[model samples]
Target: MISLPLFSLLTDVAVLAQHGPSDVLITGLTLDSREAGPGIAFCALRGTATDGHKFIEIAVGQGLAAVICEEFPATMNPATAYVLVKDSAEALAHMASAFHGHPSRQLQLVGITGTNGKTTCVTLLHKLLRELGYHAGLLSTVQNQIDEEVIPATHTTPDAIRLNALLARMVAAGCTHACMEVSSHAVAQHRVTGLRFVGGVFTNLTHDHLDYHGTFDNYLKAKKGFFDALPKTAFAITNADDKRGPVMLQNTAARRETYSLRGAATFRARLIANEVHGLHLEIDGREILFRLIGVFNAYNLLAVYGAAVLLGEDPMEVLTILSGLTTAPGRFEPVVSEKQRVTGIIDYAHTPDALENVLQTLHEIRQPSQQIITVVGCGGNRDAAKRPIMANLAARLSNKVILTADNPRFEDPLEILAQMQAGVTAPDAAKVQTVADRREAIRTAVALAGPDDIVLVVGKGHENYQEIRGVKAPFDDKLILTEIFAELNK
Candidate 1:
């Protein structure tokens, strides 16, 4: 119902050329031609998969209000408006912001970006804000939220129109702050172009998304672009422990600060103990035990604490609330079979570095006699370069490994297992098994485990469905694991 004259929506948009009427009343905006209508303007975005220019004629024929594109068609409709720009994506971003009345500026929005820990860090920050008696919104890989109301999320970061609309809803619902996860794909595609942030947090960079970015360097640049765009009034907090952490702040205009466990930093924490139950740390000269586990979470906690303080909250109050906070779902979530005493940990460690971190953390904390059995796989149509690396790490770190299918969308599952099998050496090959069925793989790992042994299920942690050949089927990992435990151990 947020109708605006096309001329008003073009306020901050870069216009290279214009034709036809600018007074067309636009009620909705979309990139998809199927959604085009009489009062909607179709933004002809050139995406990696498909070009929106191909459907401009169809959109216009269906009575679109206007066409925003990089290039005009051979034939122009006298009844429709046309605006040409350097980048349609960027234009759409600003237009969407204008349509939504620039809601990001109304709240203290914070964005967290990196290869890992983005979900956990932002989720924690949103929870911390609510604990401090502020209404907040969350945009993350897991879900979007306005205080306690949950909105199912389809992407790590949504497209421009949806992004601003969500923020607008938050502002209207009395939200004072918002925490969002900024993915590399979202930044490179101009999905987050027009949002204003009060602060930005960098988790860490690693080898992932090579298929989309084509190289590690491009991936790093995408992550850095988020901070580079931050205004001087905002704050940029990064992990000092990561070698590439400081690189994020070099060109950023925002106030630069750091947090680390291994070195001195603007905000530092000393890890006193790390157990399966929780982590004990000395943060700002105060020792407190946190509910989240692993060194990765220790860094996430530090990032959240730093952001809250930069937002003008008390350090002691932030620490007090952070101590009882748990991690995001499927992040090292533990499921135990009391009958057999077997422990199962489900995590979303899809990359080489993340898997190694989890395995290393388990190694340091598990009982000496406890054997780690790992079941992991790579998703189809992703960075296949990491398949071998994932298998290699699991084989080297765990007592046993199982390569299984993970969302084989239009790809052969067996072929994915073969690629993973290539990573195991002859010595380690003997301990590895390939199970094409994921549920069976988890069942087998559990049945093979001795009492008190640890079974790790990685890759698709919090997801509730399995995508195969363009079809998504209900498949919750935690639900399946619990059911298998009951049937086998009972």
Candidate 2:
């Protein structure tokens, strides 16, 4: 569908290869050989666990016009064009953008980065933009959308070729705006290198991805890359309430806009009223009511409003659109039983900060004599340091806590529960029970909730699959809750 000439898009053929110049017209770009087609250029990227270089020959044999590899092959065929690059991943992003005629430049692109709230903020912006008469697209952990059709997402941030392809699709579909969640891993790995973001948002940063980056400083640097690459015309939206927000503001080349729920902010949310059903707040001196609960979501809404304002939308208009916005899948998503006396919530609060924020928000709206019970677990092979912290927060906040397995990939589920148990030192430790099966955990948590009690199922929010070892099994928190709720009513 893209009509750009392939020869014109090759910026560094010599860097990618030491071979001769060929008159091959590349029609597409890809990193995986399985996805490569005729006339496509293949990028051989070396990932942490898998090397794409191993598939160079297979790609070339499968009718690829050119192969971009980290190093030139000693036995490459003379007929096949080879380009050598120092870093194939970065080169792929740059070349893919060029090949797609730089579709990101044609649209108003916004990139939001943080440990949490990125998906929620991006989804909110997408909804607001559509209500404001702009055709909007979104790419996030939950799903991918271009106008009306929704596509399943394979990664938090997709690979370069697929990313450009998606952008081209959006452009073709007449999308005037798009919002994307820029993960720290995606930024560090050059996943979004060539795309020009019109606005960048930093929600907040916490201790996460220590296993991948090795240190907190490295993680911060990776997140800073999003704003550092922004153009001068772009706006950097930051959370002034976060301790690291000031530091992040200092690192950007783009203009700055700050939003916060606490402390002084350019766009501040003054809580007018809080209830279990929704929240009422005064944003930027304007009283606005929203259907989203929790103080954390108030921050998320502020960020969404700030970015919407940067795009030239009216504050009240944005608020009106958000006031009608429903909860994202599994993010503080509420479930009701037949009698509708008990309300259940499912959220992706795996970290200590996320858990504390969600629980505190529930406590604020809870009725007198009502209790809050929680079900949560820590993922295996991730930052094990946060397990005890999350447990301590849950123990201190909730009336009851249930520990269970959350994607215990290649690690014993019991070991993760043991680490969490260390932090829960209450005499009512008996209130906290360990369930290795997530489904059973959810059923137990829901069954224990009284008519006035609110139950929360945390971690693995919108995800429909449970990863164990290397396979992903079918599982969805929302689906499970709906089924259980139906049975309870019967």
Candidate 1 deviates by what RMSD?
Answer: 0.8
Which ten residues in a row are the worst by lDDT in model 1?
481-490
Which portions of model 2 show Cα errors greater than 4 Å?
Answer: 1-6, 12-17, 338-340, 426-428
Let me know the TM-score candidate 1 reaches against the reference structure: 0.99
lDDT of 1 by residue, 1-490 (tens): 7789999999888799999987899999999999999999999999888999999999999999999999999999999999999999999999999999999999999999999999999999999999999999999999999999999999999999999999999999999999999999999999999899999999999999998999999999999999999999999999999999999999999999999999989999999999988999999899999999899889999999999999999999999999999889888999999999999999999999999999999998899999999999999999999999999999999999989998999889999889999999888998899999999999999989999999999999899999999999999888999999999765
Note each model's CA RMSD in angstroms: 0.8, 2.0
How good is model 2 by TM-score? 0.95
Clashing pairs in 1: none
Error of 1 at 119 (Å): 0.6
| lDDT of the candidates, in the order given | 0.95, 0.86
Q: Which candidate has the highest TM-score of all?
A: 1
lDDT of 1 at 21: 88
What clash pairs does model 2 have?
15-84, 16-83, 16-84, 16-85, 17-83, 17-84
